[model samples]
Target: MSAGPSADDVPAPDPRLVADLRADLAAVGGDGYRVDAVTALLGLVADAALHREQPLAARRVVTAAVGAGDPLAALVGAFVLGLEVPSDVLATALPRCGLDGAGRLGLLEAVPGGRARARLELRPYAAVDAAGGADWWVASDLGETATGGPLRTDHVLGVGGASTTLARAVVREPVDRALDLGTGCGVQALHLRRHARSVVATDVSARALRVAALTLALDGGAGGDRPGEDGAAPGRGTVDLRRGSLLAPVAGEAFDLVVSNPPFVITPRTDGVPAYEYRDGGMVGDALVQHLVEDVGGVLAPGGTAQMLGNWEHRDGEPWTDRVGAWLDASGLDGWVVQRDLLDPAAYAETWVRDGGQREGAAFDALVGAWLDDLAGRRVDAVGLGLVVLRRPVDPSRPRLRRLEEVPGTGSGALGAHVADVLAAEEQLAGLDDAALARRHLVVAPDVTEERHARPGAADPEVVLLRQGGGFGRAVRVGTAVAGVVGACDGDLPLGVLVGAVAQLLGRPAEEVAAEVLPAARGLVADGLLRLA
Candidate 1:
């Protein structure tokens, strides 16, 4: 992989040239301004590319930007394209792309004259020198300012918190075949290509696919490889780009891994306005997410896994766990669903409406009101936000059905690894019965902790509490003998033998201790905080 230029290393374009180009652009007023401005911008990007040793990349960015439309829109399109442009020049050139004298454009700032502008100023592109590339992009969104106006009902968002969160949370393992569903600008697919041998990236929008293709091509070209090498077998690093609805393009094929950051927004689609290709999946009230979960089973190969970020309706009488559990059981796959966040229907509707730049108080509130009516009509009390991971069940006769509360904190690469670990454990213990489980000594995972709480002015003055540090931090209560047995677990002895010895040391009846300790140990094993040896 070849490295692009560093931010500090990029040379600033000549001020005299910029001044002359601006004057020329201003002179070509009315009908000619668009053409003149585009031409000048292309030249500037090309000049920067040449200075940073990537003239081809610069030209590609210019081409893509010219086709994307408008001054602000073209500028945003150019920035993503310019990822391949040597950074040494981009740092100095980016500020110039802004209309403000300060060279800093707030992504949340509304476009002039009620035009919908792309919020590309978010830290989707950052200069890094890792993996042998000077301008390797590091995803960031810290300095992002919130939308100030009412969100356009149909808005095309650039990179945001939810997008990056899903990207990082996706499992990045070496696999023979992979698929990225709803691949907006191909960010998820771009990350998948790093590990998967072959990746098929699909989207419903031609424009999104075009941008994704360009991103792949530029990034690959700058790294000295051809982009668009899709459909090739494992280890080839090829990505097949497809344009279609979810799973429709790859109907017959089964992949080792599949991932999606689908258009999961639960919003009301009114009248004839076209839904934003990037955000709306055209299904009503969590239907898109439900469809993905239901259909993914048909495409995942045996031993394969699928990970998705989804939202589901939380009806008044239904427990979120029961709703998700039903989906998993019906899918015929061993699955784990972690509900990361919850929002009441009104709160959820308002949050997303504002997200699209619909911040005008009454207008935004009205839009949100419409969404709540839709949800209420559908019996949706709230929305459950979550990450779901599924593994194709090996046994047809018996399928795994497990649903737990959400894991705390943001799910990232480490969380992906944790899911992989959980799957491995499930497989290892698939057929083990009580006798076999007793023979294996399970260690209380390091993430499990015990706490003692003291009560004042009480007959029974103390309580012992068991807490799991990872996953959902589920709490349990246990006796001293069970705690000692857990503490001594170092993968050194069988459970039966360890419990037997502990009972003797504590002067507790062996049978009595066995009844209490065994169930707690089994529960720990099932929760994946303990590894059964």
Candidate 2:
């Protein structure tokens, strides 16, 4: 595999050029470029090829992006098209920054005949979170699609699928302080500012931190301690960029929320197989993820929450839950873990090796073999990928809520509100006794629906399911008594009274029916299907 640019090659984007670039991006129209526009520009065949990590088809569109008068087209050619453009074309694209400023920003390198090629990938990014929609520019090392080769060890990542996943998963309620651990390119930090009063983004790689600082600067939320125009001190747009691994930089300091899309990829420790710092944590097996699970709560204030994306190894005899459960137990924090994907050894090996841009060649085969050997040595059968949301209990005397399950298709979209609601429910349920819970009136959530299925010739339904229309889309199988109880919950009567009425209709003891249905009711509330009125 051929190597791409090193971390040292990434130069600090000047704030002045950042301002000019921001203006240039705005002049081209909203958010610079959209996915649909690029797709239309590249056509179906070339777009599909580009999605498959091959840039040859995209390279064919070089003339289109460069020759067009739109600054969007010229900017696309210079960066996304991966083509050297004439100095005049670049100047036309970024009239304020110009080629000289681009070169100063280390985004482009001067070539022969006054032509310049992009040394890095810089583009506009747009997103809609709980706060609403906004756009910003981001710069990171060129990927395999841009370079058509392997990535450097410390490649600063751009906004990709994983970045967006964590961004949407983050709980977006206003808070006093927030921290973005292992904040590569500072994408999470940028999003955190939407809700957090102050955000501190930290990373182990100094180069990554520099790139992250540039990313925030380009986005208008420039990091540092500078005061605002009115002299009231910087607010939402200000971030404190720090350099450290895990939570060491902010040790003993407490935060209301924390988010991370860490280097949780499980890689083998074998010779000739390069461990990329962006993904690998330089630890054996899944130790890095385990360590985070065991320690992230130390910096969290009471009732604070942390969300992260990670991977765990599964041995032959033990279940995936057992592996992750142990880590949660060690942390002593209330946690809800959702395993999103699982991959066998072969599939896992191919995914990572190819992720490093190594095709199905001898090197790829060798790396796969090493990965398999490493797994075999540990008696591993498969790997589980998931999202974990943890919280430090406000009442230390209460037992921590521990929930571990697999949700392969939790569906897509922002889950910040759903997660926050679940945590809140857990706290509420933990505080309430059985008598107190039964006395409270409840209502079914707006997004919940009931479905009944029966045999073709049958008159009465045999199966009943309560499905959530949004927020994790959980479907709960309900028995006759529970189904009736849930159907009657409309914020009018207390749960105990409803249970008594149902028990009378079924000719059963109220105490016996209450014992059976109350647990399920609590579960429904915890998952956001039902709420206290």
Candidate 3:
């Protein structure tokens, strides 16, 4: 309820308190105070559901759990579940660091009648990336679920859907140096450490950098230190936190990889509209995402990859690809964009207005009007929300890959590995001509299956669908010729031989079959449906 800490007055977390808190949490249960333990202790199914977003659902159980002298549950109840506890109970729970120490750490504040409430929200974070599954504690400002109101303008976000989406979308590859731009709470920076030898996390808000520093310290598997005067060393994998807007902090520095879940929300530049620093980049329309795409290349080393999430405006008659592709053309980076979802002006406005915790009332209506007017003035029809992957080619003279398409609901597993495969395929395909490609042996990926659909009485199938069981879960409809080529791919013979054999069976010229199937085969290879033997 106290308006949270300002940028300048942001309190540094005490290392002793953090250690005590970690030990206190570990005493309760394994996984370091997991959500399931709290839910099971509370015995409330409704409280366990994160989609509900009502933190008060487990109040009774939280109070009871705290009263029962469960230190982990007490901390979870007070900080995560957002409940007030008596000063004595809190002191008993965190005996190492009493209420005074907690107050100094900016975690909780004392209330009347010997009671105290948590100011900072803390919870266990679990992730499964290329390095396998891991757990850590993350601390950030209380959200609307706890505060029961709109988020503060400079709110530091926890592990939300957007951050999770970006975490999965990023291509995880081992590199010497990586950068996490707009590193809110340092989620991406943590992921970056799994592969990159060193990470540089930068943000515009000092408050956000403070929260990120706290997050990095709490999740201290790697060395938790800011970059040195000469940057990070080779094997230490330092997590360096910097304060600046966008790429200004990293100017004149080139990174091997850069990942961001940036502040890409488009907002009206009109007066009276609150610009949340975590979401809005203080730009007109979709320029923030554009600026990142265009300018991020400056900091990317040759052969470096930059993966980010963004929103783009689509005007009437103009395709979303053209609108977003223009930014890539200007960036001069090889780009792959996948527009996952699209929203009309009305729907987009409603979504953002509600995101700010504004209910459907007069003030909400006024804000919605401003959004609509801004869109109309710019001749915008809809907005596309998607993931972008850009790579600075080692050889700039070649024609760069510019693929813009719609790929939605790609499933829940880590897509980073898949993305890396696709990029490698792109690079391999770039070097191979048609004749060279035909000479290489190809094999259908293990997860791929072929399905034949036909009428009940028909012996011959009317349609064939090659579906992928892993990766992007894409289904490619193919003709019999291509299907025969795929079925014959046992890593036995080169693709040219298989095409020739199929051509002989189908009573067609070998050259004709080779020309037709070769293009489709290349497409399949790029998407990981087929692999080189």
Candidate 4:
């Protein structure tokens, strides 16, 4: 990967300092500095305000806590809140790693009046993966909130919305080998370690890899090939850091699982445009996303899975699915894409132009105009942003599952488990012939519910709906035939028997009713609305 002029001021990853910092943070981070504790201290209004980029309330709360000799308040103010703390107070906050270690790590900058300020963002991160809950301190380059200016063209992002979205969306099943492509600050790699026996984290920026190494080491996972188990994983492992762009670092090797939140943003290649490395892969338009969609299969072992978040253009005279479907047609893998949002050119331009801290002004308007011109040149109508799930089937003869649709509510539950179940069900359904499927017993998922809609005084329902209470929260309208077939699926009767009873009750041929309901049954099974008995 090309370095291409990024931030080089970050301190090199020092194993000793990282370990010392981890110990010191743990000493103070337990009850006082944890996510819950910090939330409690900040109160709901201030915490909510901080998320909205209004930090005045949080600053007030932390300022008072600091006066009360709260070490956590000192840590939060100096690092998270971007406030300068007295040197003595910071020293009290971190006794072991202390001020010297902080200086060596480039985490602190000396100010006048014996005060120190944070050069990096360090905060407690807590989340639940498929395995269980985790709490770890993450370090990354400070952002516009702290710097009070535009972001660097090659900023290494901390734990942000995009990172967490991909993290929660990733399939957390255990794997023998895994790869985290574009591992900025090693957030995804941190989760990968919990399930993968070996993890290869690669990045284009040497600075990013350096920070990633520090993050990995601080989590007590040693760098290199020696396998180690964390409390969160059944068989945790080592992280091997590599420097390269895209799939170059692991060219010949294939992994059982690969997760990437790549720099798939569509950006103009015009001279004046700042190509941020964290978002832009130095590629024009949406070609980076296209390249990843088509080429990621090369690194997947048989039956291996890959999950990615990407953006694709919806050109005029073309559907969004056709644009992404073409990529999957070229790839020899089963693909499922869920488009979460569709933004028009104007909205897209405004969102991205302001992403680099450009407020409404002449320069911001100019950049937005540039985005509009670049997009219009390609006849782009809108851009669809979504999650992409791909799997290289173990059996090459198996038919590919190429599904692209919009699911409203994702990231609301354990999506990893739901995806795993869906994949397994699809594979099982594939092996079952029509006759075999009829013989199989199925059960309605516990979260499944039925709703009926009709005219105010009508006896029969005009519309029947089957709704999923969890795992994507999908709702599908069904005919009475299909609805009856599903409602009787209590794992007590075979599917064919249920269809037969519904047909007999309606005075219709069993074959016709089965033909209508079977397809819907298969779909509901794959969507987690029904389960195999």
Candidate 5:
């Protein structure tokens, strides 16, 4: 048996090769090989199962298609399922690219028995980012499901949950320049291209850079051009690919927007631990996150922001906010951190062990044990995984948006817009005192709704909840008076008028009502339940 494909073998996509490949991929006759087409061929159940890495059902569907000589199935079999396809079938599938071009692109490697195996995993990826919707082909090193083995150490990843999370959470505001700190498979760079005039994508591994180049080229969508020396990378975008570890590639440079799905996974610093370059940052504990938190501001232009996903350790003596907040305070950047998940050491160990392809075996047990021991050594009881958004304050001495909290929920929508809204709101509120704020006309956000819960027989005796339809979908419980104040916020009157009205109706002192509801109003405004008219 010959060796399987490794990081050493990857696509070196040239403009000509990429054009031909893109054309064949977009060919008509039910062989177009797009996300919708592949899903229809595999059926919903098989397609969904494939996403969960249970490919037996998808394989069966593709096998039936192969028997019927379906060209799309052949492409899916070789690329998606990692199954060997007859060379002639592959040739037919990629007619314009042809077998030689695919081989030259390091996309297909010939095997014995007159078959060709896929060198990398390529599939249709669809996303709705801040700019708009796009459907494109993405390529990267095959995963455990496709390879049927442990991942390569330097494996480049395709679009996964974390990458998508970072993408959707990026503020869609157009900017002159943006930076993708670790551009694995170039996923963020593609999204950045939509709004950013130019993108600087940096990665530590040469292999990842190669995969990113190919993905950027082939995923250019319709009417997109290949990358050129003038920085016009494929997809009608400009990217300057750089090589180095976090922040090192573009040290002195500042960008209007900087995004990263960095190597923030905390790993055991043990000799036998197989560190994947895509996830592990080779740091002790959560130091990498701390490092990024403390230093990422350096690259942000004034009034610029950086968004990233990361993990932080929860120890016995240290509060996570203080632990992470110290970094923010020291860095002198406006920062907000939302802790989404807090998992115990054992659970965290099991998660990453399975992530590296160890399911249930002695090796998996050993890896988990190692991670647990490492955590124990540092007295780490829990781990926090969440989103980090930071900005370089226009004024270094006075910053407005320093916040840390637990917002555990599946985010409702593009969080970038929500984040941007909050930032703008904070800055606006900072300029106004409580008395001045009362004079401003405020309206309830369109998506905000009030839910009152009470016993059937009890009237006005229980709870009132203000629910947000978007953002983090937070439900804030309020008193009857606050609810009345919020319900009246329709942009028609100043908040002071609404407060006095509620006070009179409640038969309460105007000062007491103002003291109680005004603070609540401030909180609601920051949470996006209420907005300025």
Candidate 6:
């Protein structure tokens, strides 16, 4: 295996090589050739690793290629890990590797087979540049294409779905201090820098942190470099990078915001060994996620927020909400847990195991069996996956817990706004009474559109339809009673009183009207179209 450059022996990227790489990447017509060459190189190394069972040796070859001062090095690393690294696209990035003075190549090199490929991608630099420079780069496996094959346990992938979801979900308000825990490839940290005065990014894997730092430096995402003539530094955010598990590195410090996309895969290690670095949290069950949820409150300042994407087990005879609620309750933080998706045990096991490359045959079945057994042993029946938003309250009264089922039709960006509303309302609730609520004006949600249909053949040809604009475009029949209640919700009446008045107008029992309208009314409130008085 080839070795990397030693401290004294490492040479700077050759200026000519850097220029050639940049030109090649920028060259218009050579995209196919670049992708083919890079992917072929990755395949060759993967085959070699599989034949020899020496993963590190295979990785060394990729490192050498990147260290050769060619942009193709990083391309090869991304490709080997199943990331969509278009040669033509990355060619434009070659100049950056050399321009930013980012030293050291930290590539995402994965063993050729297992679930690893699904989770991370490898990258490498020609050399390690000094820290705190004006230029840096940080790349993650967000928006990368999936290679339609079985996942390898240690496969590092390029960008994909989970990465972007977490990125957009993070709170973007400006803050004095912020932390990106489990900062895989530094994606969250890079984003956090925009709003935070000071940002700290930490990860359990040294390799991940190294790549993250390099990505930030090369991409000018982390704040360090001076602004160019345009007044934009290549790297503008002041980010402090650390290597540690979860919150271990920043034990005593509290922050205004904390974000994480953790390794929450609940898979068991065979032979007492972890399957991958990118996805496995290395706990027996959901312990890792539980620990993160349970401990985050201690590190959050009063009124600070923690947002994360996590997976929780659904046990037989146990409601998913109750299980997640317990975590929030234990944390002593006001929180909202929304289960956006759920998977049956069999489906969940197959999805993750197949992600590791075990498909639906005997090998796959055995893996599934192991997963089922693990779940059964612990009485887990399903897997609940979604986002958790927690607010550390200044008052420290019992924390509020709101559980919501997934409304796939709703927009995620809107959900962020809803969270803000929930927090605001929670704070104002102390001063609010039924009479106060009665005086508030509520706007009908834009998403809720009312359509009046006229049927010429009917005795009373008019019908009102309440339609939701997103998701599946679900439509509900709204009788006059419902319509009257909605029309009267101009924020001037308490919801309870509005229901009573509408019932009286329609000559119906208030109890029956209340039963039907209250739920829908609350939904409107939660969706931000209505406000509690």
TM-score (all chains, Cα) for each model: 0.70, 0.92, 0.93, 0.94, 0.97, 0.70
Predicted candidate 4 versus true structure: per-residue lDDT over 273-334, tens digit per residue? 78887889988888988888889999999999999999999999999899899999898899
Among the numbered candidates, top TM-score falls to 5
Model 5, span 1-533: residue lDDT tens: 12355556775676788889988988834548788899999999999999999999999999888768788888899999999988877788888889889988889888899888898888888888766788778888777888878877888888888888788788989999899999999889888888877889999988888888887877654335645432334654487888899999999999999999999888999987899899998889999989988898889999999999999999989898998989888778889998988999999999888788766899889999999999999899999999999999898666457899999976887888988998888888877788998999999998898898889988775989999998888899999889999989989999999999999999999999999998999998888889988
Better of 1 and 6 by TM-score: 1
Task: Write the residue-wise lDDT of candidate 6 on 343-389 in tens digits.
Answer: 88899888777556444688777888788888888898888887888
- Local error of candidate 3 at 137, Å? 1.3
Better structure of 2 and 5 per lDDT: 5
lDDT of 3 at 123: 74
Query: What lDDT does each candidate get?
Result: 0.61, 0.81, 0.81, 0.83, 0.86, 0.59
lDDT of 2 by residue, 286-386 (tens): 99999998899999999899999999999999988888999999999998898888999999999999888786888889999999999999989999988
Model 2, CA-based lDDT: 0.81
Best by lDDT: 5
**Across residues 132-235, which tens digit of lDDT does each residue of candidate 1 receive?**
22211222111112222323332334555676676655666688999998876666666676677788999886545644543444232233334346421122
- Evaluated at residue 56, the lDDT of candidate 6 is 54
Candidate 4: misplaced stretches above 4 Å?
Answer: 1-8, 221-235
What is the lDDT for 459 in model 4?
Answer: 93
Clashing pairs in 3: none
Candidates sorted by lDDT, best first: 5, 4, 3, 2, 1, 6
Which is the winner by lDDT between candidate 1 and candidate 2? 2
- The local distance difference test score of model 4 is 0.83
